[model samples]
Target: MLTLPNILTLSRIVTVPLLAALLWWPGWATGYLLGFVVYSLMGVTDYFDGYLARAQGAVSRLGIFLDPIADKIMVAAVILILCAAGNDRFPPLIAEVHVIAAMIILLREITVSGLREFLAGLQVSMPVSQLAKWKTTLQIVALGTLILAGGFREQVWMHDLGLATLWASAILTLVTGWDYLRVGLKHMD
Candidate 1:
């Protein structure tokens, strides 16, 4: 439907490769800064696309389908890139105590996605809950902070704060994920 909201969503999907490329070189601090800027812009567009779609009554099947896919792709790419970078202090974002949290978040995404697909096939909609919104917020903050930490490696606090947020995000992920799974199970045979 080439609507403005749809256009915004597609733009996010299109530019993710550029984001990935920017994060590919671990030593490129300036590149991580640029990547952070790009990632923040993507997050902004994500908010507006959904808002405009709702406000203008322009919601479409295409937008609905692409929105979560774009989000998952963005989140997955950032996580993988950050985890692989392995700085002097953190080594990997998923190292030590952060590993379980990261794994939980990643696994929940996969589980919820599959659950959504299964429910969709049954004509059952799994609406986003308020807690799920918090989960998304925590994820954005966690990843964005981690990216900024990459840009400013000397700031141990930045990475620490990012790790804190990552754990919080993981906690919320478990809660919201179980909620979704519970709803999904009810729709199953």
Candidate 2:
């Protein structure tokens, strides 16, 4: 339960508040720079936790259950913080379209999480699709890029690139979420 891998996972959950604090203020270049570093470290821990769990063959029930929850919590927090910061600073840049894209991704995460819980209750395990994995990969990259861009806003192109990646990620998220829901629905009836 308190294995090294689990400890790494727990660290991510604990550090999210500090991450949020760093992203609280818009145009706080230094804050965003620190946030980017912390965020990247969190992402690294995310990878190592799973890798260590598998390598050590210490995959506990708690680790299995808490891993995805930790991921969702982190992703959701980042989205909310980015959206809030964007709104406060670059209102036009994070306007309706951008907000909707973020909302769509958030909604999909919640919906899929609920569906996964339901499927678990039904004793049906749903493996992640390749596309879903790709989506997650892209989503992480997109968010990381955006956070870095926030820290380096003097370079307008960086922000533009981040926003573009974000939209692309949102599109993939919708597709993958729908795929997961479709699979889950088949088991429901």
Candidate 3:
């Protein structure tokens, strides 16, 4: 149960609070830079955990279960922290329409989670689609770029780019979320 891959996944879950703390101050460029580093490291761990698990043939039920949970937790924490920190300061980090994108991502996460559970209860496995994988990639780039933007506050371009990807991810989120719901509904009464 305690394989290295699983440990790596667990480490990401363990590191969420520290990431949140580092991003707590929107005005603190130093903190944001460090937060970007921590966030990057977490992303590294996320990749290696699965790579090592497959390479070593150590994949377990625990690993399968915890991986997505760790990802969601990390994403949610970043979104919430960014929103809160932005509000705490003057102009919001997630700002106006970007907040809607964030909300879409969050809502889709929760809805998909519930739908996944429902499908699992019916023993109907709903595999992630390729488009969903693209959405996940967009989400990673979007959030990471946004965090990096916090580090480089003067770089309006970074923020703009981040928001662009964010909106893109949200659109994909809607499509993928609907796909999951459609599949889940097939199993329902």
Candidate 4:
């Protein structure tokens, strides 16, 4: 269970607190910069953990279990931090929109996770759809762009682009979440 791939996955879950601490101070350009770096590193580990697991035939039950949890934790931490910082720095219109977008994505994540857990207990595994993977990719890009925008708030366009990407990602999230629920619901009966 303590394979290299699993270790990488575990590292991401462990580093979330430090990431959160770095983003705690709103409008601190340096903190946002550090947060971006930490966030990028977490993203890298997320990719490599799965690749290494497949390549090395180290796909253990623990690794499979912890991988998604690590991802959700990291994503949740980043969204919360960005929302807090954005609200404190920007005016209500932009801040509130971004906060709502973040909340939508976060809510979908939690709902899907719960559905997956419930289905797992019933020996039903709902395979990930292509749209869900695209949604995840967009979500990560949107969050990364938003975090980078926090440090570069002087450029109004950066925040605009981030917010645009955020909304796109949220739309995809809702669609994919519905797809997953549709599949899981059939298993209930």
Judged by lDDT, which candidate is best? Answer: 3
Which tens-of-lDDT digit does each residue in 33-106 have in candidate 2?
Answer: 99999999999999999999999999999899888888888889988988876544454234557888778878
Model 1 lDDT vs. the true structure? 0.89
Per-candidate clashes, comma-separated: 1, 0, 0, 0
CA lDDT of each prediction against the hidden true structure: 0.89, 0.85, 0.92, 0.84
Model 3 TM? 0.97
Q: How far is candidate 1 from the true structure (C-alpha RMSD, Å)?
A: 1.6
Give the C-alpha miss distance for residue 103 in model 1, angstroms: 1.5
* Angstrom error at residue 66, model 2: 1.1
lDDT of 3 at 110: 99
Q: Arrange candidates, best TM-score first.
A: 3, 1, 2, 4
Flag the better candidate by lDDT, 1 or 3: 3
Error of 1 at 33 (Å): 0.5
Reference-based lDDT, residue 117, model 4: 91
Question: Which pairs, if any, clash in model 2?
Answer: none
Q: Once superposed on the true structure, which residue ranges of model 1 sit more than 4 Å away at CA?
A: 87-90
Query: Model 3: runs farther than 4 Å from truth?
Result: 87-90
Clash total of candidate 1: 1
Residue 67 error, candidate 1, Å: 0.5
Better of 3 and 4 by lDDT: 3
In order of appearance, the predictions have TM-scores of 0.95, 0.94, 0.97, 0.93
